[model samples]
Every structure is written in C-alpha cells, then in structure tokens.
Target chain A: MAKVGLFLGCITPLRYPGIESSTIDVLEALGVEAKILQGTSCCPAPGVFRSFDQEVWRALGARNLALAEEQGVEILNICNGCFGSLSESSHQLREDPKKLEKVNNILSQIGKKYNGTAKVRHFAEFLYRDVGLENIAKRVKNKQDHLKVAVHYGCHFLKPRMLKEIDDPERPKILDELVEVTGAKSIPYKDKQMCCGAGGGVRARTKDVAQKMTIQKMENINEVGANVIVDVCPFCHLQFDQGQEEVETKVPVLHLSQLYVLAFGLPKERMGVEAHAIPVNF
Target chain B: MSEEGEPKLVNPEFTKEVIKRGADTITLCFQCATCTGGCPSGRITAFRTRKLMRRVQLGFKEDVLPSDELWLCTTCMTCDERCPRGVKITDIIMTLRNMAVEEGHMAEAHKRTAGMLIKTGHAIPMGDKFRELRKTLKLDEVPPTVLCDPKLYEDVVKIMKATEFDKLIGERIDG
Candidate 1:
C-alpha cells in the first residue's frame, strides 16, 4: 500500500467535510494509506490567485508540493482546482530550473524549499490508474445498478491539455469508466465537457453568470435522466449542489469519493451523504 | 456624418507586457474568432475572448485594462485548448487581470473573496450551519485546516505578505 499525502483544498475542508471524510474512507478501503497534509493552505485557487499574481500562485502551490515532498510521498488531491495549481506549478518548476529558483527563494523565507520532487495526482486518476478498475471491481459490495450518474469531469481535471495530459481532454472516459466500475450507469449528456461555471473565479466575481452556466449544465443532466451528478472536484460539487438551489433545481450532487464509498457498502452516514444540499434518495 | 479621423490609441508596451507575463503566443492570433465561438462566458455575457485577443495584438491597453468584460471571463481554458493559433488565450486573460489589479481595476466581489482567502484560507468560508453538518457526519466540527488552526492561518498570511498579495487585494498585513 503506497502512502500518499492528501491535499484537501480549502473548499473540501471548510465547505464539505463529507467529501474529505468519504475520500479517506474510500482510499483506506482500497488499501491505500492516506495522510492529511499538515500546515497546508488553499490550493489558493489558481483561477483567483493566479489571475491576480502568478508569482504568488506559484509560491503557494510550490509550498504545498514541498510539504508532500518532505513526507517523501506524492500528493493525491481531491479538488480539480488544486490539481491544476499544484500540478501546473510542479510541472513548471520541474521543467524550468530558473522558475524553481525564484519559487524556492520565496519558499526559503518560511523555512521551506521545493526541490521539484513531489508530483500531483488527482484522486480520479489515482483510482483509475494506480488502483486499477479490476481491483476496484472485485471489492465492490454494493453495486449501484439502480443509479444513473452524470459524470462531471470538472475543467481542471483535463484542460490546458499540455499541462494536464491525464486523459483525452475533449472526451475523457476515465471518470466514466471509474463510475461504471461501481456498477452505476454513466449516462451520456449534452455538453458533458463544459465547465461547471465555478472555476476561474466566476462564482465569486459574477453570481448571475455562474448560476446561468450551472443552470445550463443542470438542464443537460436533467435531459439525460441522471438522478445524481458525480464529480471529482469539491468546487464543482459546490457549483452543482448549491448552484442548483439558486437555479431552483434539485439534482443531487455526489463527490466521486462519496459514490465510491457508497458502492463500497459504507452506509450513507459514513459517507456524509446528508450534507448534500439536494438529498440523495439512495 | 463628417469624416473626422480620431486619434488611433495604440500602446505597443501593452502587447509586450502581456507576452512578458506568459501570453507569449498572442502574436500568433490572426483574428480567428474560434475563441469567441467557444467561450462559455461570451455566450452569457458581453465578454468576447477573441476580441480581447485582437485588442491585445492591437495594444489597446486603455480599452482593455479597465473594462468589466475583463472580469467576465471564467478562465475555463476552453478557448486556450481549442485555439487554432495555439495562442494561450486563457493565460493572456489572466495576465490582463494581473495588470488590471496592478492598476486597481479589480472587481469588488473578487476583492472580498481575496479578503476571505487571506483571513480564512478559503475563498468561500464555511458558515456555522455547515460546521454543524460536519458534526452530524461524525467528522470534526472544524476539519483540521487553516480554519481550525491559528498557526496554519498565519502561514497563509505570511505567504500573502511575502508575495505582497495582501497589498494587491487592498489588505493590510498588520491587520
């Protein structure tokens, strides 16, 4: 069992502890040792902070990566926004020594150094590539045969295809396959690859625009008859869960960890399914 | 309609600054509207990512820097990914935003969120009801995050101070 540091970005720890708990439960159930990343701040939200100051964004991201490197473990992050920031910063710093030097100079003031050692891995990629579908299939005790899932591969998971080359950016099948491994049907939906309208600081800077984007996504999901939306990022989860309330829709949203925990035969109580704004009937 | 020619407003330094900020491929754009066609924000708002690209190439710094349309971008990267010219459209938008912040042209909501981030390490801080919800789930009332630890919160503030992020967002380090 590989011990991996978990980078729980701001939203997951503060807004949705359920996703945090379920992530731990699911990873532990899969025989992977998950440790909380100590003394970590926000992924700082790449869209928000990066837009304001790229140097600060790189420093913050490098700091988080250095934490995982000090533990001698790669990071397994739950939020796609964190994946974007950490992975992009790690990639940039690793590829460019000058940038690494600049970032390390900033980090050294606070007793830290990023030697460009740690790598960032999103939880979806971890479950699919590291855990393997066959191994996950064997452990599934409660197959969600009755559930129809609309998989939301949040933008950061597979965007800027150069930086995050995890899957086919246009038509990513990894999340769909991972969802299917739990015996749930990953239904096809319109604009499946569209942004959740929450990323890039849209949700903060402009409410009506963000809500309109969410409403459009919810309408697409409704058209596909998906009872619940399964997402990998908590920011996207928040957009779908709470964003639905503003749009007057009731589509239940589940983090991939929550869905995986559910299919692992863990009760809803253990997965913290009750914390959802739109209750999950199953 | 009298044909009175208005002065052409062009600041070549604007284009140079954007490239220096990491949108080095801005020159590759050939007025292709693919970015605008694919922009999600453009669909719902007055933001045209392609037009912004054109404005950058033309060095329309004054027009581009202080516009509300600049903040309308969600930075979804859809435009960047699909651009035929291989222009880093989204990064350019981010660069423009950084310049806007330097000129004190930030949106109010974004400033408020930045204040929240500096204070709580979260753009959207968790409310009390959500704290109660965590307890119901048998998890820590406050997850072991910056919100739960004073030292960690200070570390976040320290990084902000070092980067002058607090100052950029109109925050005081002493506070």
Candidate 2:
C-alpha cells in the first residue's frame, strides 16, 4: 500500500465533499494510505483560465504539482480537470526544459519549484492499474448485482492521448471495468465518450449550451435505463447530478469512489450520498 | 481578374500569433469539417469548431475575436482527438480566446468567473449550502483547501500576482 496524495479539486471539496469522503474511505478500505495535499489552489480550471492565459495556467498547475512533489508522493486526483491540468503540466514541464525553467522561475517568486517528480493519476486509473480489479472485487461485501450504471469518462481522463494515456480516448474501458468489479453493469450509451457539456468552462460561460449538452447525455442515459451515472470527476458529476435539474431529469450520479464505498458495504451515510441533487437510493 | 474582387480578410499576423501560442497545427486543418461534424457544442450552439479553425487559418482576427461563439467552446478535445488532420482544434480555440481577451473581448460570464477566482481562489466559491452538506458528511465545514486556510489563499494570490493573472483579468488585488 503506497502513500498517495489526494488532489481534491475545487468542485469536489466545495460542492461534493462526499466524493472526497468516499475516496478517503475507499482508499483506507483497500489498505492504501491517503494524504490530503494541503495548501493547493484550484486546478485553476484548465478551460477558463487557460483559455485566457497559458502562462498563468501552467504556473498555477506547476504550483499544485510542486506541493505534491514536495510531499514526495504521486497525486491521486478525483476530478478529470485536475488530472488534465496537473498531469498535463507535469508532462509538458518535464518534456520541455525551457518551459520547465520558465515555470520554475515563476515558482521561485513564491519559494516553490516543480522538478516534475510528482506524477498525477486519475483515481480510476489508480484502481485499475495499481489496485487491480481482482483485489477490489475480493473486497466487495455488497455486490451491486441489480445496479445498472452509465460510465462517463469525462474528456480529460482519456483525451490528448499522448499526455493522459489513461485509456483509449475513442473507447474507454478502465472506468467501465472498475464499475463492473463492484457487480454493477456498465451500460453502453450513445456518445458515451462525449464531453459532459461542462468541461472547458462551458457550464460557466454558456448555461443553455451546457444544459442542452446535459440533456443530450441524460437522454442517452435514460435510453439505456441506467439507474446511476458513475463518474470519476466531480465536475462531470456536477453536470450530470446538477445539470439534470434544469432538464427535469432525475438520473442519480455516483463518483467511482462512492460505488466502491457501497460495494465495501460501508453505510451510505459515511459518504454523504443524500447530498446529491438526484438521490442515490441504491 | 478585376480590381473589384472582394477585399481579403486575412491577417497573417493573427495566424502567426495563434501558432506561436500553441495552435501551431492550425495550418494543417485543411477545411475538413470533421471537427465541427463531431463537436457536441456544434450540435446545439452557434459554435462551429471547424469554421473557427478556418477563421484562424485565414487570420480573420476581427471576425473571430469579438464573436460570442468564441466563448462557447467546452474544450472537450473531442475534435482534437478525432481530427483527421490532428489540428489541435481545442488548443486553437484556447489560443483564440487568449487573443480575444487581449483585445478586450471576454464574455461577461467568463469574466465574472475569473473575477471570482481572483477574489477567492475558486471559480465557484463555496456557499452555505455546501457547508451544511459538508457538516452532514462529518467533514470539516470547509475542507482543507484555500477556503479554510488564509495562508494558502495568500499563496494563491501571490501566484496570481506573479503571473499578472489579476491584472490580465482586470482584478484589483488589495494588499
């Protein structure tokens, strides 16, 4: 059981603390030590900030990664946006020495630096590649035998394939396989790999466009009769969980950790299940 | 060939700027609508990712910078991932956005969110509802983040200041 720093992005801690709670609980259940990397700022949100200024995006991302690098542990990020920013920054900074020197110069002003030692891993990848599905399945005290789930990979988890390299961008299975390990069937849906309509700052800048995309995804989820929407990133979770409210759909949403927490037979109360906009009754 | 032909809208400098800003692949886009065809935002909004790619290639800075469609991209990278030409469509959009902001063309909503980030280190700052929910989860009312720690918040402010993010976004950071 290696020590991994949990990078809880802005939305997760502020909007969906339950995901954080569940992630911590599930990691403990699997005998992995979870350390909260304190003093970190936003993933600065890749879409909004990066759209306006790449240097600020890179520097802020480097700062967050520097925090984890100082702790000497790889990051275990639960949100796709954080995974994109931190992982992409680490990759870009390490691959390009000029960019590394430039970012380090900015970090020096704040007395921090990124040597690119800290690697960012999405939680689903952490489970699939590191924890092993069999090891996870062995601990499922309560099999979600009747549960049907629609897995939302969210764009950052698999996109820009050269950088993320988590799964096949066109056809992702790591998340689906993780869901299946808990006895829930990961149902295939139309445009299963489509963006959650909230990425790249769409939710903030354009409400109707975001809701329209959410409705489209919900229609697909509803078409498949999925009882729950399983996602690794909290931003995508917000789009499905809260975005559905505008469209008048009630499809329940669960973070991957929440499902694992349930499969471990942990009480739902421990994970703040009721806090969701759409109730998770299972 | 008559001298009355429509005036060219090209501004090669804009194209070169986008390329320098990391959208270097814009030149390879080849007018293929594959990006727009596969774009989820294109399906609903007025945002045409392919058209935007072409606009950048033609260097139509005025037409591209001030349009509301510029802010509508979700940056999903779906277009970039599936592009036949590997045009890095999303990165191009991001570069255009940066250029747009430099020209004072940021959408109001995005500006508001940027202001919030400068003020609180969060685009969507925590409110009372989240505090109550966190209490129910038995976690601290504010998770261990910049929200809970002023020192961290100051550190965030320092980074924003160093990067001139506050100034770029027109935020005034009081010492």
Candidate 3:
C-alpha cells in the first residue's frame, strides 16, 4: 500500500471534520495509507492572506511542504485551496532560485527548509488517476444510482489551466466520470462550471456579495433539479451546505469523499451528517 | 465625484512595480472586456476586471488601490482562463491586492482572519462544536496539526514573526 500525508486545510478539519474522516476511510478502503500531515497550518488561504504578503505566503506554504518531506511521503490535499497554494508555492520555489533562497531564509529561523521536493496531489485527481475508475466501480458496495448530483469543479482545482492540468477547466469530465463510477448521475446544470462565491476572501470580507453569488449558484443548481451538490473542496462544501440557509434553499451538500463513503456502505454516523446545516438525507 | 478635478497623473512606476512583482501580463490587456464579461463577481458587484487592468496599465495606483472594489473578486479565475490575450487577470488582481495591503487597505474581516492565523496557526481554528463532532466520528478530538503540537505551533509562530506576518496583521485580541 502506498503511504501519503493528508493535507487537511483549515475548513475541513475545523469546520467539517467529517470530510477529513470520510477521506481517510475511503482512502483506507481503497488500500492506500492516509496519514495526516502534522504541524501544518492554513494553506494561508491564497486569496485572503497570500494577497497580503507573498513572502509570508510562500514561507508558510513551504513550511507545510517541508513537513511532508520529513515524513517521507507526497502530500494528498483534501481541499482545492490547499492544493492550489501548495502546488503554486512548490512550482515557484522550483522555478525561482531567488524565491527559494528568500523563503529558505525565513524557514531557517524555524529549523525548516523547503527543498522543493514535496509533491501535492488533489484527492479527486488521485482517485481518477491512481485508484482508477474501474477499480472504484468495483468497490461500490452500495451504488447510489438515485443521486442526481450537480458536480462543482471549484475554481482552483481546474482553472488557470496552464498550471493545473487536471482537466478541461471549462468543460471538465473528471468529476463526472468519477461520480458515474459510484453509480451516481452527474447531472448537467446551468453554468455548471461557475464558482460557489466563497473564495477569494469574498465570503469572509463581504458577506452580502458572497451570499448573492451563492444564491445565484443555488438557483442554477435548483433549475437543473440536482438533488445534491457534490464538490471536491471543503470551502465550497461550506458555501453550499451553510450558504443554503441564507439563500433559503435546502439541497443537501456532500464533499466527494462523503459521497464515496455513502457508496462504500459506511454507516451515516461516520460521515458526520449532523454537522451540516442542510440535512443530507438519501 | 468632481469632473473638474485635475486628471490624476499616470505613475509609470506603479505599473513597473506590479510588473516587477510577476504580473507582467498586466500590460498585455488591450482593453478587451473578455475578463469583465466572464467575471461572476462583476455581475453582482462594482468590480470590473477590464477596468482594473486598464487602471493598472495606466499606472492609476490611486484608482486601483484603496478601493473596496478590489476586495469583491472571488478569485474564481474565470477571467484568467477566458482571456483571449492570455492576460493573467486573477494573478494581477492578487498582485494589486498585495500592493493594496502595503498601503494599509485590508478589509476588517480579512484582518480578523489574519489575527486568527497568528493566534492559532490556522485561519479557521477548530471550534468546540467540531471537537465534539470529531469525537463522535471516532477520530481524534483535535486532528494532528499545528493546533495539537506545541513545537509545531511554535514553528508556525516563528515563521509568522520571521515573515513579519504578525506585524502586518497586527496583534490579535481575545474574544
């Protein structure tokens, strides 16, 4: 079994621990070792904190990468935002010697150094690639054919297509293909590639604006009659799950991992269903 | 709102400064509105991605920085992905935001989040509610992270200090 460190960015462990637990359970069931990366901080959240200071952003991100290097494992990021920040930081550190030197100067103070050897893999991409769709299809103990999921390919996971070669950012089929493997229908929705409006510090700084965007997305999903909103990112998970209350719309939201957990015949208790503001009932 | 006010001088230095910081694509924008048209935040907010790029190109630092419009972007990167000119619109916005912060133009909510990082090493710290939830899921009450280890948390604080994150975010006050 291949062992990898799980990079659980803030919102997953702090706001939705269920996503973290479900990811571990699903990965373990898939015969992969999922160890939580210790001493990791926020991906520093690219849009919020990274916008404030580049040096600090790179330093902290490199610090997290360094921790993974210590454990002798590649990072398995559970959140899109974490994957974006760490992946971008790794690319920058590898490409720019000056940046690596400056970030190393900061890390030296804390007895850490980012050798740029750390690798990050998004959980969804890992499932589609390493785990193989056919293998996932075989593991489906409880197929959820009744689920009409509005798949949300959150911004960072696929956008800036030059950097993230995961899929076609505008017309992605990776998530849809992955969803089908579990016997769930990846229903088409209006503006399916649109963002959930919880990113870029908008939700944190301007609630009304973020709420408006979330409402717009919810309306689109509602129009398509998607029974559930399935996303790969925890922040997007929070936006859809909790943002439903503000928009006065109730569509049970599930992180992709939880969707798999349900398909794996895991008990609902393991998913922390009660933690969601929108009740996730089958 | 004064139409008769003297026209602001275009500071070429500001444009050069942003370009130097790695948003060289700021100059590649040819005033095409592809970025604005695809922007989701622009649809609901006063943010205009095209105009912001234009302002940056013209070195209108005063117009671009210190404006609440800067905070409205969701950083969704839709504009960046759709630009025909291949301009890195989202990256330029981020670079502009970094400059905005240097000018002390951070939003209050962002500052509060920054403070949280300073105190807990995680912007969104684990609340008591999640602690109970984790326990029910048969997981560790506190997921092994900077939050559970003192040495790791100390390293986080030291990095924050080394990078002047604590200084930029200011001191955090207890709730």
| Best candidate, TM-score | 3
Q: Compute the lDDT for candidate 3.
A: 0.87
The TM-scores, chain A only, for the candidates as listed are: 0.96, 0.96, 0.97
- Each candidate's interface RMSD (Å, one decimal) is 1.6, 1.3, 1.0
Give candidate 2's error at residue A221 in angstroms.
Answer: 1.4
Candidate numbers sorted by lDDT from highest down: 3, 2, 1
Clash pairs, candidate 3, are none
lDDT by residue (tens digit), candidate 3, B1-175: 2155878768899999999999998878898798889899999988898899988998888888989999899889989888989998877888899888877888778888888888898988677988999899988898788888888889988888888878877732222
Residues A70-94 of candidate 2: C-alpha lDDT, one tens digit per residue = 9877888999898888877778788
In lDDT terms, how accurate is model 1?
A: 0.84
Model-by-model lDDT, in order?
A: 0.84, 0.84, 0.87
Q: Mind giving the per-residue lDDT tens digits that candidate 1 earns over B43-136?
A: 8898888788888998989889988888887777888888888988877888898898888787777777778877887667788987887888
Q: What is the C-alpha lDDT profile of model 2 across B60-155, one tens digit per residue?
A: 887799888987888888888888887777777877888788777777778888888888887787889889988888887887878788988888
Q: For model 1, what is the alpha-carbon lDDT of residue A170?
A: 86
Sliding window of 10 residues with minimal summed lDDT for model 2 chain A: A241-250
